[model samples]
Target: MAYQVIIIEDDPMVAAIDRQYVETDSRFQVAHVLKSGGEALGVLENCRPDLIILDFYTPSMDGMEFVDRLHAMGQYPAIIMVTSANDREIVHGLLSRGVLDYLVKPFAFARFRQAMDKFLQTQNLLSCSQESSLLDQQAIDRLIRRQERPEPGGNQMSKGLNAATLERVRSFLSASRGQALTSEEIAEQVHLSRITIRRYVNYMVETGELASSIDYHTGGRPSIRYSYTGQTAEP
Candidate 1:
């Protein structure tokens, strides 16, 4: 079953965008879109969502008050803050209260995707711990290290290249197998901007994770197509 998510943003447009980003990953579903924390609190017990995308400022109740109320009610859903508020005090307070991730307003889709990936990773680790009843040192370390870390590619990724986004592109190309696709095509499939997709594809090609070829059938300047190389880069 897909994990349920609730979005709490007073702005309708931002709420729609949050829903779009959340639904891009097949593993999650938006369970509710509420305008304020007061409305959210009304349904939290019944909905019991796994995650929430929240804005700091709202009409009835602010983000901090919402969090405090949740704690008082003994409900602790994972939260990813997406708001214009960048005050250091607000951020520090939310972090101390265990918000899973924070994104300032005007953030890119890649950054949003990264936050969702982190939440999923944490959920997976928690599930494993529940089944085993005991976690090894490595497992504990992974849970504690919430910050983004380079994966698959042992070296740090280049600027603007996110590991989660790169993996999404790689996964799509790998599934395509025999067919190679241009950046635009891949972007459409993966719900990422073409330029972002192109950057990742180029990085993957350099790392030997993808192979590229020129396609001249368009009757204009030849376009480059990428395919998974069937080889994993050595760390």
Candidate 2:
């Protein structure tokens, strides 16, 4: 079943965009697109959504106040803030309140996908923990050290490579384990260009995150295919 999502944005265009981005991933479906935080809060009273795409500046209640109200009501859903607000105080407040991810306006689709991927990963981990009733040290560590964007000079990522895009590719390939995929196949699913996906796959191959093989059965030039190696890449 796909996870249910609710979007709270005042602008119709932005709300539509958020819905489009959220639904792009097969794991999530937008359950509602509310224009005000107050309306959203009322809706949350009965149903608990898996995630929420929220804007900081909305009628009825601002994002911060909305978060506070949700906490007061003992309702905690994964939240990804998609707003134009770049104030450090607002960001810090939202982060302190445990907002899963924040994206300033004019962000790329890659960044949006990265946030969704993060929420899905966290949900998966939580589900595992619930089933096991216990978490190992590594599992605990992974839960605590949620993936974040690398610093500008961070050597963890190669130059000219985006951490978010790399994660998207890695997550998709991981899901398709046991099946080798060409760059074009991956690009089509991830909504990225074939050339861009090829670059990322090459980097993953070099870093040992993916195994590459040649497929000569295409009746023409042999094409390269990549499969996840079941190895976790350094964050």
> What are the RMSD figures for all models against the true structure?
9.6, 11.7
95-148 per-residue lDDT for model 2 (tens digits)? 999999999998755567668768877787777756677878876787778754
Candidate 2 residue pairs in backbone clash: none
- List the global CA lDDT of all models: 0.81, 0.81
Q: Pick the candidate with the highest TM-score.
A: 1
Report clashes for each candidate as comma-separated counts.
0, 0
Model 1 over residues 6-100: C-alpha lDDT tens digits?
99998866776778667655578898999999999999877788999999999888899999999899889899999999999999999999999
Backbone clashes in candidate 1 total 0
Model 1 alpha-carbon drift over 4 Å, by segment: 152-235
